[model samples]
Target: MEAKGDGSAEADKADFQKMIQGMLEKAKQLKPEELVFRYKGVLYPSVPSSVQTLQALGNFQARPEDLVISSYPKCGFNWVNLLLRDIAFINQNESEDGKPGVRSQLKLLEFENAGNYEEMKNDPSPRIYGMHGHYNNLPSSIHQKKTKILVVFRNPKDNAVSYYHFCQNNPLLPTFSSWDEFFRNYMTGEVCWGSYFDHALVWEKHFDDENVKIVTYEELKENLAKGVQSIAEFFGLSLSEEQIQKIAGRGTFQAMSDNAEKTHSSFGKVIFRKGVVGDWKTLFTKEQSEEMDAKFEACLAGTKIGAMLKYDLYCKE
Candidate 1:
């Protein structure tokens, strides 16, 4: 009886320490105002990637061979996460030989275990990772290594709509009840990730490097087979074309949304919701589209992105 009590007491102490630590960390991070974090743009404050090294946030411990998926929010992050999840890790399929009951998906790839950047570095064997971080926030070391980066960019109009729902459901953001308030903040780049224009530009510039490759969410949606091939090649993974097609088919926007619903959230909503590319058609007014285009032109100026984007004309559906 005494020993059990002692064990409970130790657990309580550890929990208390964790609570206090979390509070202190939160205190250190700048307050979110109008959705933009004051000291945050690409750089984030102490956000731990793992329980082991809880405070070494944002710093990259990258090597050249590592694979990083960088995307703006609502830009196929979950799709890529699920894709890399399958490619990078596999479970022992009920082999007659006993292994632990089953493996948690977390143990499969590098991203599952990492709560922040630091933990992303601690994985084994050609590690794969994901982040919503803007271009400037990435570590210089990672850049110098010429680490293989897969960047996913989506049209900002749709991103804005998706981000609105995400923030509404996200506990961390100061919730605004009205779309009017949300759109104002979003247009001004006052939210967590900042101006979608600036963020996308940074990523586009990075793709100029040999090791960096850009993929569009629209392209991925239209033809996931090719998207899978592009990403797989970027990470130096070769698979048969047929196998790649299979992966693309399985990791669809609809499938992920349906699968995520069964999950119970300790946080606000289930992290993965609808993955459709252009719910914005229903949401964006003509004036809003024009206003959004002004930002796009300025950010995408001097690039051939305009023609490519014109041809694809995503979000029409």
Candidate 2:
């Protein structure tokens, strides 16, 4: 199937909207990327045009109050989304001392009010967004405004293993057999999203100036309470003890994976194989693990990112 020209028959904005509607009406006939809710790593049979339109519509300019969560695919994005949602809920109807409401934090969550990056950048007050885009690709306006970033990463081995499974089911990411092939691409930074080290380096380099912060899947899984609290402090929000428990409990891999399945959420890749860290130990041979570690060290040693990573040494007290 060939890509269709997005009908530009209309000269005016109103006419463009009409054509977009017409295109969207047939979007289901096209594919996921043509849909309004398309994410990367989700290919559409008819997508090149859709991708262009999406890029134009979703360009984020950034805001001083914006809270952007950046990560590669399968990098605890849902967990962070759930955490922020719960935090926002807790902050929604608090008492004078910022105590949480007795009712369920998520009970009233309509799950709307979030929009595309472009929409989010223009919104009043604080805006929160989760992105799988690389740092270099971020909008110039965002950099100009010095937008805050919360980054998340997982162990490369486990990340690769999970990515393999995800791409196996994903229309966008190629499903390849043999760890050698996958590792080759992964180490070369040619995998879907981008290189893990590059992503981590961008944050570490930018963190000091832009309020950029990082969290690890290992940390989030090892001590979820600390993870929640760490996130709270980073965002300059206070969480009650109860709210902490709720977010941590719900943000766990098991809980979030269950929620994704129950809600038929966008990140179904997260649910299919929500395995924990150290899965690398099971999946990678000793030589493979050592090879990856060597690559990581070669890529990031002595950098600020090196201080930020926990990797196989995660959970060391």
Candidate 3:
């Protein structure tokens, strides 16, 4: 049994190395801008995602029972995705087969191939799709069906810092020479998925909509158990207190980080790095901090979503 396990581990390691090599080769073929394709004024990474997929997003059909997780990049997307999957799995009474099935099973609507949209259209009820796009760009059917949409956002300062590190590590994204340069691009909506503020403001308009639930990353971090319970309730799933506690404990940064290899494969480390609040303080200069603050004031201040972020508590030093 030990020998078989060792052999399987070695094969997994080899497969991960090959995947990285393929990404590096693909990166070599394209300029930084070519790494992403622009559609409807939003930049999407072109690696696993295609322009054709984005174009077909509008016509895609959505069922009323469908659930959508929408967020800009690096905004606790993985964390929420995992938690929801666990909730769904437990609700269904599915047994864990000891495989990293949850991450592998989830699909990003924007990143899927255009041809796959047809497959998704025919998929059965209780479907969940993840996406990063402007609120207006989602399938019109979603609105018509009143599909539940969970909009997860983070404070901009920490979001920017996390995004910078993510871009540096992921070959699918363009790298910057310095944080200052990246900060400038980030402020101007030059990064993948466009300006964070633009995305937030649009989603904020729908906060009162019955189908839309606004969740902030900081709130999840501060009280994950409570957050998980709220999310379960939003999804109309009833869970015992014990189940909620277990999900919360497993969903912490350290627990998820430790299990990333199994859940996320080689990309796990890159995706799960330092899931902490206020890391921006280590990297942001006084001026950069002020600039982000001013942008927040101009765009999100006094908005319902802005209050949800608790900006003074999380972003301010």
Candidate 4:
């Protein structure tokens, strides 16, 4: 029995190593421009995803009770997902040892293979997905079913800084030679998931959409308890003040970072770095700041989402 168990463990290790090597080889095959592949005018990361996955997403089905947390890369996608999962677990009275089981990972709608999609479809209802694509790229069933969507966004400057660091640390992502090059690419919508402005603008039109709710990283960081309550209400799940406080306490940046290894595995460090509002001040050059400002004004000025960004407070020097 012991020998069989040891053999099974060894085989699992070998399979894991093989998967990693395959991913590295695929990353090596991509040219800089090919790092992010385009499908239907939107960009997706080439590593860990394929055109087939995107095609599968086009015909993907969504249940009405399904909830989605959508964001551009590095825009609090993971954090918000954690909170919503906690809310769901709490609301459903699904707790183990008096604690909410919120560490389970949610599926990324854009990265799943056909088999995975089938698995998700067959799984129980109230499925939560983390999405990083534009609104139009969402599964048509999501729209037709009026699935509730939560869109999380961050100020562009801070988002770019975080995204740069993430790329540098994540082997699955292509790294830039310098922040300057990355900044230029980011401003032009060359990065994975395309321009942040484009994403914000498209989602902006849905501000009044009954099924969609928008939140900001800064808003959550400022008063997480309030954010938690708002999200609970948005999901039609009423929670007591005590429950909100407990969830917010567990969802803090420091708490999440400390638990990242257990919750996110090897990618935790790359995902949860200095979750602050103005880290961009340390990285963005004056010219880059001006450029982002110009783009924001042109694309989102006077918009509801623009006001939510609080750009003048957190973005400007």
Residue 108 miss distance in model 3 (angstroms):
1.0
TM-score of each: 0.73, 0.71, 0.90, 0.90
After the best TM-score superposition of candidate 1, give how far the Cα of residue 11 lies from its true spot, in angstroms: 19
Candidate 2 residue lDDT tens string, 42-143: 322232234554355335456766666777766776567667756765755545654332211111001112243334444455666655665665656667
Q: In model 3, state the lDDT of residue 300.
A: 91
Taking the tens digit of each residue's C-alpha lDDT, what string does model 3 give over 1-317?
00111335455555555655676688789998789888777778887677777777778888888878999999988889888888776776745652223433446787666667777767666777878786888889989989999889998999999999999999889899999999999999999999999999999889899999999899898899999999999989888897888889888988989988776667778889999998999899999999999999999999999999999999998
lDDT of each: 0.58, 0.58, 0.82, 0.82
Worst 10 residues of 4 by lDDT: 1-10
Report clashes for each candidate as comma-separated counts.
4, 0, 0, 0
Runs off by more than 4 Å, candidate 2: 1-59, 94-125, 266-272, 312-317
Those runs of model 1 whose alpha carbons end farther than 4 Å from true positions after fitting are 1-37, 40-59, 90-122, 261-269, 306-308, 315-317
Lowest-scoring 10 consecutive residues by lDDT in candidate 1? 102-111
Candidate 4 structure, TM-score to reference: 0.90
Q: What's the CA error at residue 23 for candidate 3, in Å? A: 4.5
